[model samples]
Target: MKTYNKLLLLFIFLLFCEGLQAQSKPSWIWYPGDFEVWLGNKMQSRRTERGTFLPPFWKFDSHYVLIDFHKDFDLQEAEEAELYVEGQYNVKIDGKAIFGYPNRLSIPAGKHKVSLKVFSQDKVPAIFVKGKKVVSDSTWLVTYEDKEWIDQSGKASDQSGTTWLKAAQWNFDNAATPPSAYALPTVPQSPVKTEKLGKSLLVDFGRETFGFIRLHGLKGRGEVAIYYGESPEEALSIDHGETLDRLDVQFDQKKDTLTTLTKAFRYVNVQLAPGMTVDSVSMLYEYAPVKDRGSFHCSDEEINKIYDVAKYTFHLNTREFFIDGIKRDRWIWSGDAYQSFLMNYYLLYDSPTVTRTLLALRGKDPVTSHTNTIMDYTFYWFMGIQDYYLYTGDRSFVEQFYPRMKTLMDYCLSRTNKNGMLEGLAGDWVFIDWAEGLSKQGELSFEQLLFARSLETMATSAALINHQEDAVTYGEMAKKLKSAIMAKYWNKEKQALVHSSIDGKQTDNVTRYSNMFGIFFGYFNADQQQGVKKNVLLNDKVQKITTPYMRFYELEALCALGEQSYVLKEMKAYWGGMLKEGATSFWEEYDPSKKGAEHLSMYGRPFGKSLCHAWGASPLYLLGKYYLGIKPLSPAYETWEVVPELGGLKWMEGKVPTPAGEIELYCSTKEIRVKSPVGKGTLRFKSKSLPKVKGGGGLLNKGNGNYEITIIKGKDCVVKYN
Candidate 1:
């Protein structure tokens, strides 16, 4: 009897421990990438023009309305699991249907499969299942079309084919919160000042803002019209403002009225009817809850202010996906989002946002048109993925999306002319930049450069997915294209790559686009790089880059060539130029030559420019990658380097986040301090003398005024140099 009792006690203890192990952290999950598609459509459709709804001109896709989610679990004892779903759903256990959508169901002790089929047209099909060993998470498998067919006799078909993918999830961990109820967190914000004009009020929120407008203590019954503006002039122009809200009220008592959709504006002109009345105006500021992981502080206050405003501009534009601007477009353009991805790595480092944006941009591709209807934008999408992999080293994302990448590349290759060069095709927009008088007539060198880089991206992704044959094919294509670009576009006389080729003849037009890219791509020899830098990049004859989009790469190429000092002054002059004009956030475009209200005009409208744009925030990337000089040399940051360039700053310190953690550094002419949370890092610096070490001593004094040190994980290394 004693032996039997002891055995029973051991069994009970094992069962208790198993039960505890089964109930791990539970979170809401959905068909991977589906929520992004759904939310993107909803957000993009919110644009209105003078109270009339305006949708994207390009084709838009929708998420699969029906989905089946299931996971198998084994439990020591029977447990009851709660079910929460975003839409109408049915629950089943081990092929046995529950009587209804049970709030709680008994999942038996033995191995059992729990499944839920949900249908939602407007919202993503998502579910949260919490139980002792049966929690919903990424581990759950989901299928849009289960393809389960039954005969008249009610036996299921054996040949039923279904493709299931692991579910996608974010930070929606609470059971009470479902995907349909999702909205960015909002906070109350008041106007800086308001001016009354009879039944009209003009309110300035003090800066560029985005959110719902609220009329506080609105009582009388009539109609109230609100005009939104990024500038005060835009708000006052009721006839031409891009966005406006109108409400027909019949309030018997005082109540606050808020607009249904969010708008981007800093100033609002509220015009009330003869009867309508509002005591005050405020707003519910909607914003992404992303933690700022990277930072920059330098001696130049102007540069610091530019960084802060640029950071704010990026955060505001980085909502569901990296949008073009808050006011106009409000759509994810691949080129714009590509810059946002780079900036994000230096700022938020939110992997999910990057993945989500990539997936959404790809959509469900039958390859109809280029991303955002621009040829360069499509290549930008692929290049963005390359950077994404190098920065995060998440192979699973590439694995899931490699097929999509292949199809897009195939579309590009198909569009190439007989000579394997990309020229204009019907319905294809060859948007290199927004420069006036720019030609799109012939095979463009810029397109080929981007194409070669995109091919390399595919090659890298193919290798990651173990597609050796595809990898070789893409690698050969990339090499061929690179050689062709150099052979066809290189102008020996001009010492630069010309802009385009007409009928196999190089155009005399030498543009900065391809030449600057070639410098960073290593397509040019050392001699060729110097030649192009002097003739094309530094030459005033080459049309200067005006838009921040191209400026991002132009500056990057300069930084790559160790011209950070020159780039720093350009940054201050360009980005600081905007700051000098009382810009709360960076503008979509700025030309110092444009005087007064002309700064606010673009696209032929008086106030057609967006005051805050994503591409305008490139300094976040420049400061982190080039100035801080911390970059990954291997996948997942297992091997990295820290080569700090002061770039004429008195002293600088910042953090560069990695999958492991942050690589923090402080640098001055006299000393350097470094710490890494993970990965082994190499610290390379140029010192006037042999550097002395503090903390952990491993400084190696290489000859020729150069020093090197190794940084191990979770340790601090300080060096006194110069």
Candidate 2:
């Protein structure tokens, strides 16, 4: 009898231990999107021009100052927990307040609620809870306001009006690491050489880098002024420099002082008063710790150099979010970020950055103005979502924000003209490209194409969230708009879609904007596709695209039409031109005709253009999707296709990141080798002779020298061809 009782007790204890082990891993959590908004405001406000604070012209928003977080757990046994918070906070259990900020507390078993209410003015309100069974994670709920109030009789009133969302988290898994202390990692770097003239010192960092400048052995009682520039001319012109800083320091001993803000520059012109003295100057090069998963190398050294510069340019622009540039306008623009999203999916495959940028761009919105106040940019936001879903297959993201998508679409729908088409209303910036003589008048065919695509995104999102009615409505709307685009803009004589319509008649203009998008969007039939290719795309008479922003789509259109060879040459000419001018990073705009100082000038201001822009890194996408020809046929890359097109290269090798794992490939003229960590892939290529498969089975021979072989997950496949 005694042995039996002891055995039963041991069994019960073992079961309890198993339950404790099953607890989810703890992570830092906060109100959804509150940290991102707070961080964005912090990042954007750091911009300065000639010692003058330069904030965005548009309204800058902040996160909620106060938040209440709570979670209910039914523990099998009693537990003890510790709390860490970013702001002044209070804790409660089962509606009973704890006396003070208790570092640790004990809770009894049997379904109870643990809550924390935090308030802050400058930083985001966040918390990290560590315990055995009750830990902080996304499972917890957070709200800006908890309306549970006590009546006169001390009875709680209805708390139905308060809204709660699952807590948001990133890589802040360590309890000691809070969102408020987030900063990009940095490394120490010395200047290439220094040139001193009287009280002025010109320091060159050799190449374009961004970070806080450090002053060593600084014992000064006067003012120290620093002017930063991407060009030597801009740095020397103190008054017109885009970014500068002035510091008033009074140090008793030799101590190192770091600048409060990070700036983009290759050269710094530092001037000091008589009393101010500095031994040397260095920099803390700040950067995100992202692994370069995708790579490209070919026989052409110029292409390789272009690829390297593009990668560096992308890394500089890819910080907290896909920013427009490192030098100026650090604000997130939807159109710029859309290209960044594509490039990131190909290179780093950093889904967290993608979602963060999307959510930050799509703020808690009544959809006041188009994203970045541009009509086409708003549509890019929607298209970004579609791409995010296709690449990540994160349905929860779509489900959580489906309502916001509907509201944004509704805003667009409400602004449409009486003829059921999007037209520029008052205060609407119909920015298609940054070209002279471009008109923002009447209804643009480009805007309608974007609108139709946005509707399709809404339809796809609605279906994912089980909003069947909304799905049907958006589907019908997309179909209708697409039909209208074909009927209204299709210029048979011009063999292209007209740029815009005035009053009610279509214009005679034939721009590449809508026509190029039509090719990728599949709006054009076989005949129309060929016609647009000849009339608009191939026609050099059309206004040439100046910015990489539009060049991304233009190149993509050409690649879709199997014009990879032509697109590669164009990329070489456009992106290569910037490289020849000693560009360490790709520029916001590169005009081959512009010479020396002319190349640096833009927007009517000297050195107005950004040296490193996210959109300038489109070759990452073009090379990955077109040349490597690896894309997901299904969401999350469950089933994908690899159709390697050399695009006029002797051989090309690269990796494409997927949700599950990476797909690796190496291709030459006579042999091809490919391997994937996940997904059922189809490897297709064109060869004049029969291709033999090794380490795999079954090759499908499509007529006319096209062949395909099935690639299963976790297997290496090689093919030999003539």
lDDT of 1 by residue, 159-263 (tens): 456888889888889998877678888999999999997767999999999999999999887888999999888999878888888899998799998998999
Model 2: per-residue lDDT, tens digit, 527-568? 999998998899999988999999999999999999988988
Q: What's the distance in Å from true for residue 434, model 2?
A: 0.6
Candidate 2, residue 261: the lDDT equals 84
How high a TM-score does candidate 1 get? Answer: 0.95
Q: Could you tell me which 10 consecutive residues in candidate 2 have the lowest summed lDDT?
A: 153-162
Q: What TM-score goes with each of the models?
A: 0.95, 0.95
Q: Count the backbone clashes (under 3 Å) in each candidate.
A: 0, 0
Predicted structure with the largest lDDT when compared to the true one: 1
